[model samples]
Each structure stands twice: as C-alpha cells, then as structure tokens.
Target: MTTETPVKTSNWNVPNALTTLRIVMVPFFGYALLHDGGDSIGWRITAYVLFALAMVTDKIDGDLARKHNLVTDFGKIADPIADKAITGMAFIGLSIVGSQSGEAWYVAGGEIWWWVTILVLVREWSVTLLRLSIMKDVVIPAAQLGKIKTTAQGVALGLLSLPLVADDNAWGDTGRVIFYVSQVILAVAVGLTLWSGYEFFRDAFRQKRAARA
Candidate 1:
C-alpha cells in the first residue's frame, strides 16, 4: 500500500490576510480609543467600530481557515498574537480613559480598576505563552470556560470602549443602561478569566504528568 502525503497550504491566503489586518488594527484602535485622552465621543465611536471590525474579522478568519483548510503555521501564530494585541490594547486604553475621565467614568465595572487590568493581562499572556511553548509536548484541549471568558471579554470591552459615561453621550439614559450591563459582563469576564486560567493550569499539569508516564 502506498502512503498518502499531507498537503501543505501556503501562508498567503485570505484568512492570513485578515489576521494581518487585525495585527495592523491594534495601534489604530488604541489611537482611536485614546483620542483626546479617550474623551472624544467621536473618537470613542470610531474605536468601537474598529474593535468590532477586528472581532468580526477574527471570527471570519478562523472559520474560513477551518472550513477551507487554509490553516497555516503563520496563521496559528499571528492569529492569537493579533487577538491578544487588540484586546490587550482595549483593556489598557479603557483603563487609561477611565482614569483620565475622573470619578464619573471608568470601564472597570465603572472605571475599570487598574488591578483588574493588570491581573487579567498577566493571566492572559501567561496562559498564551505557556500554550504556545508547550504545544508540542502537551496537547491540552481548550475548556469551554475559556471560550465563555473570551466572549464575555469581547462584549465587555466593546461596550466599555464607547464613551459610556460622557456627559455629552447622545445615548443618554440608554448609554447608562448599557454601561451598567457592560459592567456586569466585565465582572463576570474577570471571574471567568481567573477560573478558566486555573483550570488551564491544572489541566496542563495533568497532561504533562501523563505525557511523562
């Protein structure tokens, strides 16, 4: 019997291009979010749009890659980097905006606490690094909690990116309601981040032990 060879897909593809676009967007998204110290309603709106675009593109690229067999090593590497870069910018930019906006504003469940940002970022980056580094030796399946955490984070950050607390917000009471909702979601996201991270670490250790045995 003849052995079948695996097909190698090239790096240049639509999904990879979208991933590249996401990487390119992080800085622009940050600029928009931080425009006029994150106080400009117009800029905030722009930032939200850019963020939404990135999120949508991320979903699209992953689907396209999986459906069409366009997955590549570059796509794998760049996709997560792009995802983290943009979201990390959102977390950092919103914290800055909240701080700059004084007591009336902040995206940390109402002026996102810097500690929240710091802790979440640490967990996110550490988990990502560990996953990539040990990918070959230990294959740990993603937990559903991790997916939930990501979705919650995306929704929270998207809502928080808006000038939710601004006096000039056209959304007015509606904006306040959305802000409250986003705050609740962010709190949940933070909880999930910690919980999921713990699960990931625990599973990783288990997997490593099994691999050695």
Candidate 2:
C-alpha cells in the first residue's frame, strides 16, 4: 500500500482575486464618498453602490474560499485588511460629511459623531493588530458577536453614506426617515461594537494567561 500526500493549493484563485479587488476598491470608494466634499449627491450615491459591491464581494470571496478549500495565507491577511479599509473609509468619510453639513446635516437627529468613529475604529484596529501579533503564540478565533457587529456596521454605514439632505438643507420626509433609521441602527452597532471588543480582549487575555500557565 502506498501513502498519498495532501496537495497544497495554489494562491491564484477566485477568492484571493476578490479580496484583492476589494482592497483596490477601497480608495475608489473613499474618493466617491468624499467627492465634492461629501456634497455631491451623485457621488454619494455612487459611493453607496461601490460600498454595496465591496460588502457583497467580501461575502462571496469568503464563501468561495471555504467551500473550495482555497484558503491561502494571502486571503487570511488581505481579507480582514480589505474589510477594515472599506469600513474605516465609510466612518471617516461620513464623519467629514456630518461635520461639513452643520445643523442642516442633523436630519432627524442623524449625524456621524467623530467620537463614535474614533472609538469604533480604535477598538477594531486594536483587535486586528493584537490578533496578528499573537496569532502564532495564542490564536483567538473570531466570535459570533463580531459577525453581528460587522453586519450592523455595514447596514448603518451604507445608509448614512447617502446624501440624506440637500445642499440647501432641505431634508425630504423620506430622507429624514431614512437618516433617523440609520442613526438608530448605528447606535445599536456602537453598542455591539463595544461589547464585541470586550469579548475579544477577554478571550485573548484568557488564552494568553492560559498559555503562560
């Protein structure tokens, strides 16, 4: 009887391509989001489309990689980076839009708070950095809470990316409704964001402590 060895899959695959495409889309998405200082209604709509594309591609690539056994080192690294890049751009760009719009921007009490952006980004990046730093020594696998956080964030940010108010500060009834809904969703996301961060740090610290013991 002869023993067969497992074959190593090549990195050139659909999932990796999608991940790379997502990374490439980040800047273009940001550009569209911030076009005309976030006042270009057309560009804001364009940005929303681009953002939706990124989110869909992200889901597709991850599914493809898992289903086809095409998971590679590159995918692992680039996938999270792509996710972070797109969302980070959304947060920052939306904040800029909110700051520029002033009182008129407060449609139905909807505005992207700079403090919220900073807090969420800090928690998100800190987790990513710590995960990468201790990946070899202590693997802290992602929790389900993280997925919920991501989904909530995606929905909220996508809504906020739209030009919810006119340049002249006239907010339509529908626009106001949507803006208020998005803000409510964002508040939920922020809560989840903090809770998930706490879970991640708790798990990471426990793992590290166990390893040292």
TM-scores for the candidates: 0.94, 0.91
TM-score (C-alpha, index-matched) for candidate 1: 0.94
**Clash count, predicted structure 1:** 4
Expressed as tens digits, the lDDT of each residue in 1-213 for candidate 1 is: 999899899999999999999999999999999988877888888999999999999999999999999989898778878988998999999888778767644332235778899999999999888988887788777689988888999999998888776866567778889999998999999999999999999999898998899
lDDT per model vs. reference: 0.87, 0.85
- When summed lDDT is taken over every stretch of 10 residues in candidate 1, the lowest stretch is 102-111
* Alpha-carbon runs more than 4 Å astray in model 1: 104-110
RMSD in Å for model 1 = 1.9
Name model 2 segments beyond 4 Å from true.
Answer: 1-5, 108-111, 168-171
Q: What tens-digit string does per-residue lDDT give for candidate 2 at 1-213?
A: 999997888889999999999999999998998887787878888999999999999999999999989988788788888999999999988888778767544641334889999999999899888888887788776789889989999999998888776555555777778888888888999999999999998999999999999
Which ten contiguous residues of candidate 2 have the minimum total lDDT? 102-111
